[model samples]
Target chain A: MPKGVPERGSIPDDGLTTRQRRQQPVLAIHTGTGKGKSTAAFGMAMRAWNQGFDIGVFQFVKSAKWRVGEETALRALGDAHLASGIGGPVEWHKMGEGWSWIRKHGDDADHAEAAREGWAEIARRLASERHRFYLLDEFTYPLKWGWIEVSEVVEALRARPGNQHVVITGRDAPPELIAAADLVTEMTKIKHPMDAGRKGQRGIEW
Target chain B: MPKGVPERGSIPDDGLTTRQRRQQPVLAIHTGTGKGKSTAAFGMAMRAWNQGFDIGVFQFVKSAKWRVGEETALRALGDAHLASGIGGPVEWHKMGEGWSWIRKHGDDADHAEAAREGWAEIARRLASERHRFYLLDEFTYPLKWGWIEVSEVVEALRARPGNQHVVITGRDAPPELIAAADLVTEMTKIKHPMDAGRKGQRGIEW
Candidate 1:
C-alpha cells in the first residue's frame, strides 16, 4: 500500500473501468463538529466550475443573516461567467431566508415548511438535471432536525439524472446519508482559537 | 452554547473588542489522513481573495506531476485580477518541483536543499509581509521528514510581520506547529468510495 492509496483489497472488484468510474456521479458529504465542511464544499465547487460544470449552491444554514465570503466570490464568478465565458455558470440560493431559526427557533412548523420546500426544489432540480455541480451547503441541518425526509432525499439523490455531482455540508449528517454518499469526511476539531476566547471574525466566519 | 458557538465560559477575560480582535493575524492548519485538506485551504483563499487579500499558494507536495483543479481556478482568478482587478493578486508556486519525491525518493542530499530553500523563501516573505494570505499547501511533509526545521518554521511564523494570515495543509502536522496555530482542523475519513474500489477521477479529484 502506498502512502494514502489503500491496498488492493480496498478495491471491491467493481466491474467498471477507471474511465467509466470517472464518468459516474459523485455523492460527497462533509459532516463533522469542526469547521471547513461548507468551505471545502465551496472549494470543490470552484474546481468543478473550472471543469465547466454548472454550479448551483443552495445554502440551508440556520441563520438567514449568515452570508459568508464564499457567497460574494461565487456571485462574482457567476457574474463573470455571464459576462464572459471563462468558467461555468453559478447559481446561489439562500434557502434559510424564509424560515430562519434565528427568527423562529423552537417553532418546527415554520422551519419545517421552509426546509421541505427547499428539499422539494432540490429534488425537482435533481430530477431535471438543472445543475452539473450541486452544493447543498449546511444541508445536513434540515435532515438532522427532521425538517426534511432523509430517505426521500437519499432516494432523489440515488435517482438523480445525468452526471450531476452533489456535495452536502453540515454537522450531524444522517447515518443513511453517510451510507449513500460516495465520499464522507468528518472535520474534527484538533484545536480552535475560540478556545483562547477568540470570537468569529468577519472575513473568516462570514 | 448556541448550536456551533462556544459557551460564555469559552470567552476568556481578554479585553479586546470584536473589531480589534478581527485585526489580528491567524495561523491555521488543515491536517489529517483524509481528503480536502488542500481543497478547504483553497476555499479559504477564495474568501480571502474576495476580501481583497493578496494571495500566495506554495504547494510542497511530494508529487510534482500532481496538478489539482484549484491551481487552474486560482490562476484564472489571479489573471482575472491582473486584467480586470475584480479580486486580489494571486501567486501560485509549485515549490515541489526540482526536488520532487516521486522523482528522487530517499535521497536526502538531492531533496534537502530544495526544501530548505523553499522554507527560506517563505520565511523572507513572512518577514516582508509579501502576501496578506498564504496557503502553504502540503507543508507538513518537509517537517515530518526532517527536510525543514520545525522550530525555525515556527519561529518565522511567530515573528511574521503585519497582518499576514497563513494556512498550512498536509498530513502528520508537527505538535509544535499545532501548538503555534490559531486554528487547526483534522480531516477524518468517515467513508470513502476509493474504499469500494473507485479510483480517483478527473473533475472531482483534480
Candidate 2:
C-alpha cells in the first residue's frame, strides 16, 4: 500500500456501510504539470477492460492524427473480443482540431463546437449508461478555456446514473471539478527530459 | 500536448544535438502521496514491450503473491512474444518479504538483507545492460529507510553503461536520488476513494 493512505478499516466513519460504499462509483481526476496523468488513466482503462467494462475514451486536446500506443493496444483488445467474445467493447473519439479540422473549417469556433459536441455525446452516454468506464482525456482544458461550462460538467457527472466510473485528465483542473471528484491525483513536475533539452520520444511519450 | 510542456522546436539548448540527446539514457523517478505511480511505470513498460525493448521489473515492496493487473497483462504479452518471436525478453522479480518470509525470517535484518540483494542484482544487470528498460518498482522506500545506500545507487546509475532507461516508483523519494534522476514526477493526492470511505476495488487498484 502507498504511504499516508489509511487502511480501509481505519478510515473514519462517513455514515455509509461497506456495501453502500462498494456501490458508489468513482469520479477520479488526474491533473498536474507532470507526465503520466493520461497514461495512468489509460492503465486503469486497461484494467477495467480486462474486467469486462465497456470503455469510452473521449480525447479533448490530442489530435486525431496522433495515434497513441495505448489506443492501438486497446483497440486490438476490443477487436479480439469482437472476434472471440472474450472482453468488452471499446470506443475512442478524438475531439481536437487537428490538421483535418484546420483544412475543413479553419476556425477556433469549429474547434469549440467540436468540444461541446464531444461533451454532449458523453452526457448522452452517461444518461444511458452506455459505458462502465469513461476516460475524458484532457477535458479540463476546454473548461479552463471556457469552451465548456464547469457547472454543466459537474452536474452531468454528479447526476450520471448507474455504476459508471469517470476519469478526467489534464493540467489546471478547476477547483469546482476537483471538489466534485472522489479521487484526484496532481502530477507534480520535478524534472522532465525537455528540461535537459530532449524531445519526446516514440514509445516513451506516445 | 500537456499544458506548459515545451514543444520540440521550443526546447532550450542544453549543448547537445538531437542525436546526442537521444542517445542518453533516462533515469525517471515517480514519487509522492497519490496513486498510479506504479501504474504509470507499467504503462511505460507496455510501450517498451510494444517497441520490442527487453524489459526487467523489480518489485521491492509489493509481495509476489499480489498479482497486479499490469503484471498479468505484461506477462501475457511476454509469453505471446516468446511464442511468436514478436517482441523482446521480459523478466519480473519480486524481492519483497511476503507472508512466507515473515513466517521464516520475521526480522528487520532479513528484510534489509533482501533489499540489499535486490539492489546488488540490479547493479549487476545495469553493468551488463541486461535490459533496455528497467523498472525498479517501490524502490524509494529502501533508500529512505536506509536499507540501501542512496549514494551507491546514484553512483551505479551514473556509471550504468548503454542507453538503458530506468524508472523508479515509490513515495518520499530522497532528494539525492531525485537530483540524480533525469525525469521526476511527484504524484500529489488531491482526493481519493479512501477519503470517501471506499476501499481499493478490483480493476481500479490492482
Candidate 3:
C-alpha cells in the first residue's frame, strides 16, 4: 500500500472503492463575539448551492428584525429549498417611532418554542436527506442561555442523516455541541467600533 | 457587565489600539487542494491596496506556470507591493514537462527552501508593521507534509503587531493550528466531478 492511501476495507460506497467516503455534509458551528459568523456560513451556502446543492436555513434568535437575506440569495439560485420561523404576531421592542425594531411580539418563551419548531424542521430534512446544506442560524445561543434544553436539541441532531451538512451560529455554544461537531469555529473578538458606542453600518450589521 | 461583552483586558496597548494603526498589516494564507486559494487572497490584497494599505504577497509552492491573469487590472492599481519566489528561473521536472504543470512546486523539500526567502520578506513587513495585508499562499500543506515546522510559523506570526487578521486555508489542518485560529473551516469535498474524470474549469478552477 502506498503511504497516505487508506486501506481497502474503509472505502465509502460513493464510487471510490478506496477507504475514503465522499466528504459527508459537514456539521459546523460558528460561535464567539466576532462579526461575520453567519456571513461566513452564508458564503459557504452560496458556493455549495452554485455547485448544485439544496439548502435550508432557520434564524432562531431573530424575530421580525431577521430579514431573509440568505434565504433570498439561496432562492435566487432557483434550486434551493427554504423554510423559516417568522417572528409571530407581536412587537418585542421598538426603537423610537419605528426607526428601529426588535422582537417585541414574542417573549423569550415564545422565541424558544419557535426555535424548537425550527430545529425539528431542520432535523427532519437532515434525516430524510432532503437538503445538502442546512443552517440553524443562532440556534445554540438560546439553548445555552437556558431558553431551550440541550437534550431535545441533541436528540434531533443525532438522528440527522449522514449526507446533510448542518451549520449553526451563535455565541456561548455549549461543550457537548462542540464535541459532536465535525468542524467548529470560535470567532475571537479582537477589536470593534461597537465597544466605542459606534453604531453598526446597515449592510454590515443585521 | 452584560452577558457576552467581549471579556475585558483582551486588548493590549500595542500600536493596534485603533484601526488607524498604519503598520499593523493583515495576514492571510491560502492552502488546500482546491483551486481559488491564491485568487481569493489576491482579491483581498487588491481590496486592501485600493484602500491604501500596502500589500505584500509570499508565493510559496508556486511554479512559473503560475500566470497572473489581468495584468491590466493590476496595473490600474499602481501602489501595490508585488513579489514572487521565482524571478524568472524555469525549472523542469525529471519525470517530464507535463508533471511540472500539475505538481505543486513547494511540496518538494528543495523548492520549499526556495520559498524561505519570500516568506522572510513578508516577515520583515509584518515585523515593521509596514504593509496592510500579507498573503502567504499554500503555507500549510507543506507544513502538513513536514516541509516546515508549525512552531516556526507561529513564531513568525506572533512577531506581527496587533489588529492583524490572518486567513490560512489547507486540507487536514493540525489540531494546534485549529486551536489557535479565531475562525476555521474545513471544505469537505462532497461532489467533485474530478472523481468522474471531468477536467478542471477555466476562470473558475484555474
- Candidate topping TM-score: 1
- DockQ top scorer: 1
Model 2 chain A lowest lDDT segment of ten: A98-107
Tell me the tens digit of each residue's lDDT in model 1 across A24-113. 899999998888888888888878877778998887865644445677677767766777787788887765555322354344447677
Q: Tell me the TM-score of model 1.
A: 0.89
Model 3, span A1-206: residue lDDT tens: 01223323333345643223334445667676554456556544444443445556566655434333333323323321221121111111111112122334444445555555555555666678776667677777668877677776766677776666677777777888776665565554444434432333221233
Judged by lDDT against the true structure, how good is candidate 1? 0.79
**What DockQ score does model 3 reach against the true complex?**
0.05
DockQ of all models, two decimals each: 0.48, 0.39, 0.05
* Runs with alpha carbons beyond 4 Å of true place in candidate 2: A2-16, A62-67, A79-87, A96-109, B2-15, B62-67, B83-89, B97-109
Model 3 residue-pair collision total: 13
lDDT of 2 by residue, B117-189 (tens): 7899899989999999999998999898999999999999999998899999999999999989888999988
DockQ of 2: 0.39
Query: Which CAPRI level is candidate 1?
Result: acceptable
Q: Which of the predicted structures, 1 or 3, would earn the higher lDDT when compared with the native?
A: 1
What is the model-wide C-alpha lDDT for candidate 2? 0.78
Q: Which residue pairs clash in candidate 1?
A: A68-A206, A69-A206, B69-B206
Error of 2 at B150 (Å): 1.6
Q: Tens-digit lDDT track for model 2 on A117-165?
A: 7888889989999999999988999899998999999999999998899
**What TM-score does candidate 2 get on C-alpha atoms?**
0.85
Model 3, B97-169: lDDT tens per residue? 1223344544444655554544555566567765544555556666787767777777777667854545555
